[model samples]
Target: MDLQQLRYVVAVAETRNFTRAAERCLVVQSSLSHRIANLERELGVKLFARSSRRVELTSAGEAFLVGARECLTAADRAVADAAAATGVVRGTLAVGVIVTTAAVDVPEVLQRYRARHPDVRVLLRAGGSDELAAAVRRGDLDIAFLGLPEGARPPGVETLALDRDEHVLVVPTGHRLAGAARVTLLDIADETFVDFVAGTPARAQSDQAFAAAGLARDVAYEAGVAELITRLVARDLGVALLPSAFVRPLAAGDPELALVPVADGPRRVEYLAWGRFNPSPATRAMLDVLGVRGADPED
Candidate 1:
């Protein structure tokens, strides 16, 4: 009738003695006998033949015993599975990242996370900031690495500032300004700029930085990939202002391209974003692994 009743039946069948079954069940003999009687009555079948000396199973009892044992076994397995799911911390974690961000930091972070939580499966998706934001909003991604555009926060998402990286100007070795110790926005105002596509967070940041410095960047070309933009700079097509990390990998590739730090500059703040409604334990664990301390929930 119920799991306990099924367990009691199986215990009785195994022991073949009411007193011994009750002892094994850690229940009083009379109470155990009463529960068995109730189960037999509900089923309208005698489950056991009892005597003063011994107890034996009826034909119906033998048939019912097998089914009862199976039910108890299945119930135990279900409980074990539920506990494993809730407590073992093993599941697929879907993470989104901007292509530039992934190129810079994600590989190292993923390696560390895998080392720490080997049982947890990691799935990574790369896209632009807007696409990553949309994926988090749609619940397709558990968390994402995003640069807030123009300091505008995404609605219904929480963020933790990871690190601020200063933008550096990339110029070809033959270019005159490449020899400068530090280039200012005004210093490179005359040169054409290769930048990220319009509407991207990096572009917006570049525009704001130039605007704040009261200078206009001559737009020569636009490309989304950081590597491509660096290549363009290497070719002397135009100079570009990009995150320092993005330019680090390009340093060894092109001896002509110089990644110079921008003096008197605005640094880009990178944040980890996640849905505020209901964050998964795995997501929280990932933030912890990334050393991201979330904002106060009360705030």
Candidate 2:
């Protein structure tokens, strides 16, 4: 019935627990519970099926949440638009990125955005390209930086290809192929590999390349973070194929590793992705800071 009550319902639905939802909304647990109960009574529908161990949304809650989120988005946009008309940008800018993004310096960009619009709140999240792209489409993230295999782009969102880099082989300094100027898939087919977790976009980059060559690789170690993969390679666990730009800095670390170009390695394209229409003022400001627009090429 009210925006505050709607917010309480949404928070509870997202967190799936009264206590955590209250913590997120900066309220006491009992108050949050009472508000949601009052709203449920007003609507004459049970929104959540509550249990001591967990909270699950009823069928009604799932339907209600979609509208609730839209209402909040509209309300927030109205306020932000009003501020923008007066030449001030005020809103939350949620950005998502992959761990291996190398197109732009994220920290530096955030610093500049903060300095330019101190009134705006900035949020950053890290995830796989597919997940981040989905977040952008869902309006959960205002913008995202993604890395996908060559010629691939995130669907249902506006995207700009920022940079393209080939994957390079990462090996211990004393490894056999470390001295090689370049290698191909056939050359490394028998070598043990360290790679991203299976089914992830990062992992798929290499998987697609090898599959095209009709070769199979032995991925002995899997990690979510590129830094961890480099550490594993440094310890002689296995060599890895990773984006050259992402691997360069990791290879320069304490237990240094070597990078050899993979002649037939996968190429990854870094992209800036955002919702296709009516981005918030803060989101627009960020795009301006990045020197790009949704209408740019590859949109």
lDDT of 2 by residue, 53-120 (tens): 99999999999999998999899889999999999999899999999999899999999999999999
Q: Which portions of model 2 show Cα errors greater than 4 Å? A: 28-30, 50-55
Q: Best TM-score goes to which candidate? A: 2
Residue 53, candidate 1: how far off, in angstroms?
78
lDDT of residue 281 for candidate 1: 57
**lDDT tens string, model 1, 1-299?**
77877777778888888888888889999988888899899999999999998788999999998788777645644554554576755566789888667223787888888887777778998777777888888777889988754356656677766666788888899888887889788888998989988887778888888888888768879998888988888898998888876577767577978877788665676678887765665676787787664656323
RMSD of each: 17.3, 2.1
* List of clashing residue pairs for candidate 2: none
Top lDDT: which candidate number? 2
What's each prediction's TM-score? 0.65, 0.92
lDDT of each: 0.78, 0.92
Candidate 1 minimal-lDDT segment of 10 residues: 75-84
